[model samples]
Target: MKRFLAFVKKEFFHILRDRRTLLILFGMPLAMVLLFGFALTNEIKNAKIAVLDLDHGPHSRQITDRLLSSGYFQLIQNLNASRDIEPAFRRGKVKLVVVFPPNFSQDFARNDTEAQVQLLADASEQNTAISLTNYATNIIQNYKSEQAPPGTVAPMQIDVQPRMVFNPELRGAFVFVPGVMAMVLLLVSALMTSVTIAREKEMGTMEVLMVSPLSQLQILFGKVLPYLLLSFINGCVIIALGVFLLGIPLNGSLLLLLAETLLFTFLSLSLGLLISTIADTQLVAMFASLLVLLMPTIFLSGFIFPIESMPRFLQFVSNIIPAKYFIEIVKGIMIKGIGLDLLWKPTLLLLGMSAFLMAVSLRNLKPRLNQ
Candidate 1:
C-alpha cells in the first residue's frame, strides 16, 4: 500500500511540475463546456439581408421596419432596383432579399387577390438561407394576421414566395462537405507536422540538423515539404470522396480549388511549425495542436455551428481562425461556383495567416548549435 501511494504521489508531482500539461488538462474541459454551451448553436442571429421595397407603401414599409427590428437580421442595404439583388448576393453581402412588388398596400386592402412579397435567398449557404426565409415569412404572416379586425377575417393578405438561388434544393451535404474538408486537412496536416517536429527535438536530431550547412528556413522547408505533399494528396482524396460518395457537386474550377487547397495546407503547416516551436515535447505539441487548432477548427469555423449565433466575443475570436476563411472559400467555389472576384478576401486572409505563422515560427526556432 505504501509503495502504491508513493508511486501515485510521484505522478501527481510530475503533473504539477509540467505547467503546459497541467494547463491543458484543466483548460480543455473548461473550453469544451463553454464552447458547447455558448458558441455551438444552430440558431441564426444578425444575418445580413437586403430589402428591395418596390412598393414603398405604408404596409410594405411597416413590414420592412418589423424585419429590421427583429434580432435575427441586419439590413445591410435598401436596394433600389431588381437588378441590384443578384449583385448583392454575388458580393456575398446579403443572404436574403425581401422584394415588395408595387401596389402592395392597395392589393392587400382590396382582398380581391393576394398581395405578393418575394423572398429571394442566396442559397450558396443553403441552411442559413432556409432559416432566414422561414423567419421572415413567419414574421410577415404574423403581421398580416394582426391587422385583422376582431372576429373578422383580415382583408390584407401577404403571400411570401421564397426563392432559393444557387442551390434550389437545400442539401445538408452541400454545407458540411466543404467544412469537413477544411477540418480534416487542418487536423491531418497541423497535428501530424507538429508531432513530427517535436519528436525530432525530443530525440536530439534537431541539434545535429541545426549545425549542418542548411539554413533555418531551408531546414524548416525540408521538414515541411513531405507533409505538404501528403496534405495535398489527402485533400484530393477528401474532395473526391465528397464528390463521389456524398454526391456533392464540384461546380467551380478544379484547378482553382486545388490551388486554394494547397494554400490552406501551407497555412496549416506553418501553424504546426509554430506549435512545434512553442512546445518542448511531443505530448505538449499534440495537446497544443488539439487545443488551439482542432477545437477552433471544428466549432468556431462555422463547421457544425453558425458563427453569427455565437456570443460577440466568440465571433471576434473566430475571425482569427484560419479554417473559418478556408471553409468560406471552399463553399463559395464548390456551391456558388464563384470566381476569384467573390473570393479574394478569404483567399488573401489565408495568405496573410500563412506568412504570419511562418515568420513567427522562424523567429521562435532557436536550434541549439552545440548541445
Candidate 2:
C-alpha cells in the first residue's frame, strides 16, 4: 500500500514539475468554457434589420419600436421603396426586411380581417434568417395582442403557449457547455495519459519501471490515478463555469454528477492506456488519441449535432462513441434534473466500456512486458 501511494506521488510530481502540462490541465478548461460560452453561440443578438414602412403610421412605428426594444434586432436601414430592400441586403447591412403594407394602422384600427405585413429574409444564412423571422413574428404577435381591445376574441384564433423547459431563454451556452465538458474531459484525460505513457516509452524509462518491484497493474493504476484526479478537477471547473458564468442549472445531485464524471474520466483514461500500449511513439499516440477519440466525441456524440436526426447508419456508428452517452447523462442530470432512473442505461454503457477498455489495456500491457 505504501509503495502504491509512493507510485501515485511520483506521478503527481511528474505532472506538477511540468509547467506546460499543468497549464493544459488547468487552463484549457477555462479557455474552452469562455470560448464556447461567448464566441460560439447560436443565440441571435444585435442582428441587423431593415424596415420598409410604407404606411408610415403609428402602428407600424410601434411595431418597429417593439422590435428594437426587444434587443434581438438593430434597425440598420429604412427603405422607402421595394428596390432599396434588395440593395440593403446586397450590401450585407441587414439580415431581414420588414415591410408594413399601406394603411397598416387604419387596417388594424378598422379591425380588417386580412391585415398583414411581409418579412423578407436573406436565405443565404438559413439558420440566422429563421431565427430572425421567429423573433420578428413573436414581437409582431405581441404588438397585435396589445393593440386588440380587451375581451374581443378573433375568429379561428388558436392560442399556442410555448413553455421552454430547462433553458427557458434558449441560451446556446446551455447547449454547448455540457458538450464542452464532455469533450474537454475525454480529450484531456486520454491525450495526457496516452502521451505520458508514450513519452515513457520514448525516453526508455518504461523498461526501468518494468524492472522495478511494481506489478503491471500497479504501474498502470499509478499512471491512470493522477490523470483521473486531474480530469475530475477539470470537470468540476467546467461545471462551475457553466453554472456561475453561463447560468446553467445543476438540478440533479452534485455527488451523482461528480461520480458520473469520474466514470467517464476512467473510460477515457482506459482508452488512452490502450492506445499507449499499441503505439510505440508519443507522436503516434497523440495522433491516435486525436483521430480516434477527439473527432468522434465532437461529431458523433450529439455534442454539436443531434444523433437522432442523423441517418440510420451514422446513428448506429454513434453508439460506439462514449461521449454520446456521457453527454446524455450530463444533460439529463444537469438540465432535466432526472435521477438514476432516467440515466441508468447510459451509466451502464459507460461502465461496461470502461471495464472492457481497462481489461484490453491490461492484456496488451502484460504481453509487452514479457517482450
Candidate 3:
C-alpha cells in the first residue's frame, strides 16, 4: 500500500512537470466546452440587411427603424434603386433586403388595401437567410398590429413577400459543399505534408536529404509539390461530386475555381511544413494538425454555424482562420457566380497567408537542416 502511494505521488509530479500533458488534460476540455457552448447555437444576431423604401413615407421608415432596433438586424445599406439590390447581395455584406413599394403608408391607412413589403434574402447561407426573413416578417407584423386603431373591425394587412436569391430551394448541399471542400483540402494537405516531413525527420532520412546536392528550399518544395498536386486533385473531385452527384450548380469560372483551389492547397501545405519544423515526430505532427487545423476549420469557418452568432471574442479569433476565407471564396464563385471583381479581397488574403507561411517555414527549415 505504501509503495503504491509513493508511485502515485511520483506520477502526479511527472504530470505536473509535463506542460503538454497538463494542457491535454485541462486546457483541451476547457477549449471544447467554450467552443461548443459559444459556437453551436442556431440563433443569429446583428445580421446585416438593406432597406429600400420607394415610398420614403413615415410608415416604411418606421418599420425599418423597428427592424434596426430589434437587435436582430443591422442595416448596412439604404438602397436607392431597384437595380441596386442584386449588386448589394453580390457585395456580400447585405444578407436581407427590405423593399417598400410606393404608397406604403397610404396603403396601410386604407382599410381595403394591403401593405406590401418585399424581403429579398441572399440565401447562399440558407439557415441565416431563413432566420433573418423570419425575424423581419415578425417585426413587420408586430408593427402592423400596433398601428391598429382601438375597436376597429380589421387592421391593415401586411404582405411580406420573401424571395431567396442564388438558392431559392435552400438545399443543404449549397452550404455544406463549399465548407466540406475547405475542411477536406486543408486537413488532407496539412496532415499529409506534416506527417511526411516529420516521418523523414524521425527516420533520419532528412539528414541524407540535407547532405544531398539539393538546397533546403529545393528539398522542401520537392516534399510539398506532390502533396499540393494531390490535394488540388482532391479538391477538384469534391467539386465534381458536389456538382454532378449532389446537383450543386457550378455557376462561376471553372478555371478560376481551380486556380483558387490550388492556392488554398499550397497554403495548407505551407501550414503543414511549418508544423513539421516544430514537430520532430510524426505523431506530434498529426496531433498538431488535428488540433490547430481541424477544429477551427470545422467551427470557426462559418461552415456549420453562423459566425455572427458566436461571441465577439470567437468571432475575432475566426478572422485569422484561413479556412474561413477559402470557404467564402468557394461560395462566392460556386453559388453567387461572382468573379475576381468581388473575390479579390479573400483571394489576396489567401495569397498573403501562403507567402507568409512558406517564407517562415523555409526560414525555420534551413537552420534545422544545417544543424
Report, for all candidates in order, the number of backbone clashes.
0, 0, 0
User: In model 2, which runs have C-alpha deviations exceeding 4 angstroms?
Assistant: 1-159
Q: Rate the local accuracy (lDDT) of all candidates.
A: 0.87, 0.78, 0.90
Say which candidate scores most in TM-score: 3
Is 1 or 3 the stronger prediction by lDDT?
A: 3
Q: How many residue pairs of model 3 clash at the backbone?
A: 0
Give the worst 10-residue stretch by lDDT in candidate 2: 155-164
Residues 263-297, candidate 2, lDDT per residue (tens digit)?
A: 99999999998998877788778867876788778
Question: Which residue pairs collide, candidate 1?
Answer: none
Clashing pairs in model 2? none
Residue 366 lDDT, candidate 1, scale 0-100: 58
lDDT of 2 at 49: 84
lDDT pick, better of 1 and 2: 1
Q: Write the per-residue lDDT of candidate 3 for residues 227-259, one digit (tens) a residue.
A: 888898999999999999998898999999999
Model 1, residue 120: C-alpha shift (Å): 1.8
Q: Give residue 285's lDDT in candidate 3 (0 to 100).
A: 84
